[model samples]
Target: MTLDPKEPVLRVVPGPTDINANGHIFGGWVLSQMDIAAGIVASRRANGSVATVAIDTMEFLAPIHLRDVISVYAQVERVGRTSMGIRIEVVASRDRGREEVKVTSGLFTFVAIDADAKPRPVDAPE
Candidate 1:
């Protein structure tokens, strides 16, 4: 799916299991959400299976509350012969809050893989 910065790939409330001891959403949970969102973009662009190669410049900007609605946005940043880069941003909206705040952002790298799990070339943009 084509994910726009204005749109989110996943939206849901954070449950107790998603929280940390600090009374806020777990950082790992947030990163996992971002990874899923990025995977969608990568898979669609690659037209095949892909594996996460790396994540760069990941930053958590704000705390997410338990009842907050999390939105994960992803977009393709670039594509290489066998790798693609995606930028993902996680935003949160609380019931009592007036607006959504950006909770996290990162760059994800994925490499296209064939049926045999070997690296495969990704199609070039025309």
Candidate 2:
């Protein structure tokens, strides 16, 4: 899937509270951002609420430093009757935006749910 930096699903800077003892951002924090971004994309496609069912794969390529701007990009890679597999990529821009690094990436699965919270068809008419 093509990820456009010009159109990130979410973008924000890491805070001091989000840092680890190693002077890098916490993995959990990054994962949370990925999930939020993936949820937005999945919900838009589903035209309703979607829950994260699984993280099929994840990779931590580099550490994210404080003061770096984190940009998350996500796209629906595949969709089933009720579930969608979204591919998420995170990039960190540092050195006043001169340098960009791919820090984390993962494939997360989300299932659309109805008002009663039961799984619903993703293609159902809204």
Please write out the lDDT profile of model 2 over residues 1-126, one tens digit for every residue. 334545899999999999999999999999999999999999988988999999999999999999999999999999999999999999999999999999999999999999888999999943
Candidate models: Cα lDDT each: 0.86, 0.93
Among these predictions, the greatest TM-score belongs to 2
In model 1, pairs of residues that clash are: none
Question: For residues 1-126, could you state the per-residue lDDT of candidate 1 as single tens digits?
Answer: 455667787886778988888999888888888899899889989987999999977998999999888888888999889999999988888776678898899999999988888888887331
* Segments in model 2 whose C-alpha atoms lie over 4 Å from true places: 1-6
Best by lDDT: 2
lDDT of 2 at 42: 92
lDDT for 29 in candidate 1 is: 86
